[model samples]
Target: MATRVNVTVDAHLAIEVMLLTGTRNPQDAVELIVRDYLERAQRTEARTGDADDGRRSSDLQPYQPPQG
Candidate 1:
């Protein structure tokens, strides 16, 4: 069983989340918002991939002018 947590947030913020999620229950709205945020983050990470994938400035070559 998952543990239940109690949180206190500003009423206006909660209302906004409720409206966005189209839920009447504050708990459901908050849960949906958190879940959506995590999913988006994961999707972004998958699309962009790891920052350390390893191309560096030292790997670049200086540009040369063409001979006429």
Candidate 2:
């Protein structure tokens, strides 16, 4: 079973986002936005050395820096 959610958004922005994403379903759009938000939050936390449960993006070896 899926839960129904109500969200308010800017009408103009919604149209532009829908066009750019090529997804007609509002849920798809919302999922895309939420995915982006989570990714940015995770990266921000990683940059700040916010170790979660003694694990972070660096601990997972997910990022590689250039070496000279």
Candidate 3:
């Protein structure tokens, strides 16, 4: 299930995102942002407490999103 949400961003910021991600679709931009954020969140959560997860600091290394 997905819920509709509204967000406002400056025109320049949007253009920068499109150029950076190379995705013109607004939905794609939002999806990438959400996915990246969630991955970082998961890494942080694992570091906070979860021995068997094996998600150490190195596992959370930065990701350079490929240009499309």
Candidate 4:
């Protein structure tokens, strides 16, 4: 399920996101951006181990987010 909400964003950032993501709809662009952000966070957590504890097993390396 999705919730409906209104948000205000900078005009330049909105247009840039639209062009970069090839999304004409503002909502779609925002969703894509948010999804990517969440994915990156999850990936980081998986690589780095528990963030609160700050304890990591020697087997795992630091998380490096993907670059375009």
CA deviation > 4 Å runs, candidate 4: 54-68
TM-score, structure 3 vs. true = 0.57
User: RMSD to the native, candidate 3?
Assistant: 13.4
> Which candidate leads in lDDT?
1
Which regions of candidate 1 are displaced past 4 Å? 55-68
lDDT at position 10, candidate 2: 85
Query: Each model's TM-score, in the order given?
Result: 0.72, 0.52, 0.57, 0.71
Superposition error at 22 for model 3 (Å): 1.8
Give the candidates in order of lDDT, highest first.
1, 4, 3, 2
Candidate 3 deviant stretches above 4 angstroms: 50-68
Quick one: ranking by TM-score, best first?
Answer: 1, 4, 3, 2
Question: In candidate 1, what are the lDDT values of residues 1-68, reduced to their tens digit?
Answer: 99999999899999999999999999999999999999999999789776676554556789989989
| Residue 37 alpha-carbon offset, candidate 3, angstroms | 1.1
Task: Kindly list the per-residue Cα lDDT of model 4 for residues 37-57, writing each as its tens digit.
Answer: 999999998887785674545
* Clash-forming residue pairs, model 4: none
